[model samples]
Target: STQNANETQAVVASVLGLSANKIACKVKRLGGGFGGKESRTIPLACITSIASYHTKRPVRCMLDRNEDMAISGQRNPFMGKWKVGLDENNKLVALDTELYLNAGWSSDLSVAVMERALGHIDNVYYIPNVRAVGRCCRTNIHSNTAFRGFGGPQANVIAETYMTEIAERIGMTQEQFREMNFYKEGQTTHFDQELKDWHLPKGYFQLKEKSNFDARKAAIEEFNKQSKWRKRGISLIPTKYGISFTALHLNQAGAMIHIYHDGSVLLSHGGVEMGQGLHTKMIQVCAEGLQIPLDMIHIVETSTDKVANASPTAASASSDMNGMAVKNACDQINERLEPYRAKGLPWKEIVHHAYFDRVNLSANGFYKVPDLGYKWGENKGQLFFYFTMGAAVSEVEVDLLTGSHTVIRSDVNMDLGRSINPSIDIGQIEGAFIQGMGWSTTEESLYFPNGRLFTQGPGNYKIPGFQCIPQEFNISFFEDVTHESVKTVYKSKGVGEPPLFLGTSVYFAIRNALWYARQE
Candidate 1:
């Protein structure tokens, strides 16, 4: 629980040189983190604690928007050089890439981020010989920390950009090239982990059919031929994002559920909601597992006092890990009341009977993702429980004169593996896509030569706004899909981060439009 109060307590203890047990940290809910609050929150807390300790009074630290932007870490900016070898049919044969990440200042999470970039450089494709190297370059600016997709989005963009370039060189559609290189069921990644259940091909064709990709592509070509200043391009990109923390130890999560005498359930897990609807999904998991109504579950605030030593809610595995832990706790309670259930006892009656029988109404659950082992140096192991698959087709119109672009239409088909809550999952997908779009297009960070950030606020920097959204946005989930390796609660996969990679399609689509624009 990166957002847990304990994180602040630990920092405070370290700063004040006191025992951690003497410190107390409490948080109600985060306004919005998106990975910023994961580790960045600790410094402010520690500074305040130190000041209070010295002055013998309460102290607090707050940063204005400009100050915050100047000090806080942001998504890592990467410079990648890649060599891709393709066969006669434009299938990827071998790929060698070197990614240099601008890790401003200290190595906050740059090493882990670099590893993630190296791991994700393939981006749903299977190449017989692939090697990706990452270098973290230290600078005097603010350190770059985690964002939504971690480093996976940057890696996926690198791979997709090269793929798009290769497709253009070979006179093939990006969609065709992508489909041909999609990982099959038996294919192994460069890390030597065999893909157990691959759905990218099915998702690719499904999205193509649903989006009328071929027809729209032809129509765009015809329209581009007539238009002098504007050109439209369409591209379909696929993602097979491995789900789980690359570090095997971070794969575990814990939850505590307590059922009241009135049959009301109280659930708390290590995951911080962060406005991602994680608590809502956890409630749903408890309700589903305990066979109780949704309204009967009350989600308490995440506290370290309740659930200790929790992992950070990241890598898109928050729901998968926390939901399973909640389910496990609920299942334990249900198992204890099974005898009463077999007798057709009422829910409240069962709880009363269990109370009298000394059955535990409160239970703690712990879940560790199994069979995940990765040696960073060797770059080989079953690091992920399973890969979340998706495909997106984006049609964009580019202004050749200004090098500006607008996404005309976008279609997304993702496999969320029997979503726990379809609405929440869809929201996550849409939000991630838009955020990634901003990263690829409008969200540019600039710095002065002396290492001061010039884009310190919205006045100087641009982010995607309402106008940046696609005119026609269609998002759908693959039907009847579930994870083959991990037994997640409700058989659902993580939805937080995978769809961000889908935004790479928009970049390539704009690139395609630029190609036509350049010809004019």
Candidate 2:
């Protein structure tokens, strides 16, 4: 059970000139993936397998921190240029953008990543007559691969930047501009898929009210007028992220489960536990499906033998896919014991009787996301199962002397449908927000002229520290709303990647604060 364990097994088998079944891959857990381990782990496994095949002895390969940074890929660096035509009411009439992405050395996952970026160009808005093109430029540096949010965050940043600039140019608030262009139900995306159960507007107003955005803006303006060295600004941003693997076949997952005569259960799924609470959620899923105590279920380590041809656990869909698979497997076992339960037998007795009756107590479950199709040339058909929506309001104060800023406060309202675990979902929302803030403000990957990465270690690479956090952080989830189009396990939506886009508000807020300092 390795991260991207299925692909790693295949690659290793091919490298060793053996069948995939002959090789064994097992991983207990990953420290952190953040989309880095999805493909980057494959080469390491392949190289070690090759060495073992030739030497007829076990071999291993592991990269040091500096080597990993220098050799492994980073997120694709993009330079985007766009032109927009708007009506008098600030509604978008046309949008044409070209994105040049530095693919760096080789095309690892850049092609798929670029396709996602192009599809997400509109973000939460309805933009008709849109023409977005992505060009992957080959560079001399290490090949850039996937990161968290895949390419959705980069695409959303492009649209959000344009919205901010257009709002400033037209003398309207960014909030107003965003609201006017919000996607409504029945409206189609640029790719020709209908937007159903649109939640952007509702989420926007909820965040606006919760953050006291209008009053804070007025107060900041007044404070700026009185202060000489400090200025403050606030912004609200919305996100509508589509949930599914753009590649349709990669949307499927497999799970296996077994029940012991002692009433204990074992669960295995294709998803890796990267500290995102996937295993915890899986346990809850099994407990709920089997009506068993949480302590009775144990999640085993990931193994290619247990779940073959498994999809990588990125895209925030791990819970939706793997959790459903686990539930399905549990349901199968429960079905076999339903008659015993109907007879009013005890759970322990049911298990005891199940073994005596030769009733199968083991099951294999599989799930594939439905209705995902896309024609790249035409950009038509449904590429997503459903959309996850959220919004955030960020207030910031900028220093006039140094180009530094601090988040004064932040308010977030996200729709997680019916959350399976509120605590874990909230943690993901907050962590993604802070990581997005780091990407937008502090994390910059620098390189020398000779294509050497200069920011090789943590000392030079600035991540958002404790000090960068907002003094007043308020986070809440929308209540009583379920996704209309997609039926997930427990009616829950993906919470991993969508909230990262909410941090875009921080960037626009800092931009607004800079406007005042420039006027002075």
Candidate 3:
């Protein structure tokens, strides 16, 4: 419990002039942070707790949406130029990019965030001489905050744009361009990260193939050959998202697993579940570890009192970290039961004796990823983990006269390592795709000059509704593929953020479709 939201403690800290060291804070599940809760939320809670302690009265202060939006942060509005050096074969040789991130009023977490952006600047491609220099421009805008992809989405979008530009310049198909440059085995990334032992390079490729990207491209080309009013475009993006806190040491998670006498199990981990099936995965993990039925386990909410010193569920590390922690705890209990199992005691009998003997049925487990290290300004960061690759082929119908773009069908092929829950996994892919679509085609941020956010109210800001959603959306995870070195037993990486970028591809595809329609 290091941070909180109460304002009273902050007021007291100001009045009594106490340092943060003199304060205690409590953290709970946040509905959504978009990176806002990473560190900044701590200060508010600390202030409130301090004030409550001093006032001897129940104290509470919550920010209204207007105040929340005005005072809180949104994704940094980045402006930059990107160029990729490619060989005649369309293989990417190098990338040069200059990024300007509007850091807003304070540094906050932008430095670390942008570092991750630069680290993942190439997304899933292999480019040797990649040079990406970023400047966190201090703008008067509300402190630019983090969203789902953090800086990864913005940074990767530029790469996708660069690919589109290259395809246009060479008259090669976008699919061809991507196929040529994707991070294949033995390919080293821009940050000098080596690509090794990929589970399903072909699995990702097959998704693109099954999605009929070539046919979609052909249809767009055919349409462009006839259209005159509007133009349509198609772009495919892949991700090899490294799952961890770049802070190395923060790449850890803790959990507590307890089995009651009645055979029901309680599970708590450091990662919070924000409707991402994190809790479901935890249940699966616990069940797998104990060789117990899934329904016998109850996954509990994340709390400091239960599993302390936990990391935020961001960076796509929730499953990797918490899964490991939970697995470790289960392994310990299994080890304790090994002696009884060796003596041919029934498993239930072992459990009964362990409880009767007052054996510690609860275990705290921890884990940190191994062999990942990085340094600043390195041409490549050695990747202990890789970017999970995916490609989307979207067809759209655009009304050129109205500047309205409608997606007809979308085919998403994503490298998800493995699908733990087929239905839940697809939902993650589909939901994120729609959300990302909103970010590109509909979601726009407006602000006032005095550093106030105008998107504070509902009417002023617009997010895509179902009416604007794509007509036919098809989402699939590359199932026959698996990553080898990944921590999970099934080699499944996080599916929460990568698929959001698919929505952007739909937007780009609509733009391409519009261009084609105009050519006709």
Which candidate number has the best lDDT?
Answer: 2
Q: Give the per-residue Cα lDDT of candidate 2 at 131.
A: 92
Q: How well is each residue in 154-232 modelled by candidate 1, as lDDT tens digits? A: 9998888887778777888767777777888878899888887677787778888889988888899899999999889
Candidate 2: C-alpha RMSD to true structure equals 1.4
TM-score of every prediction relative to native:
0.96, 0.97, 0.90
Candidates 1 and 2 compared: the better one by TM-score is 2
Point out where model 1 deviates above 4 Å.
Answer: 1-6, 54-58, 480-482
Per-candidate total of colliding backbone pairs: 2, 3, 44
Residue 295 lDDT in candidate 3: 87
Candidate 1 vs. true structure, TM-score: 0.96
Model 1 residue 401 lDDT?
A: 82
Clashing pairs in 2: 1-26, 1-27, 1-302
Answer with 2 or 3, whichever has the higher TM-score: 2
Query: How accurate locally, in lDDT, is each candidate?
Result: 0.84, 0.88, 0.72
lDDT winner between candidates 2 and 3: 2
Model 2: CA > 4 A from native: 54-60
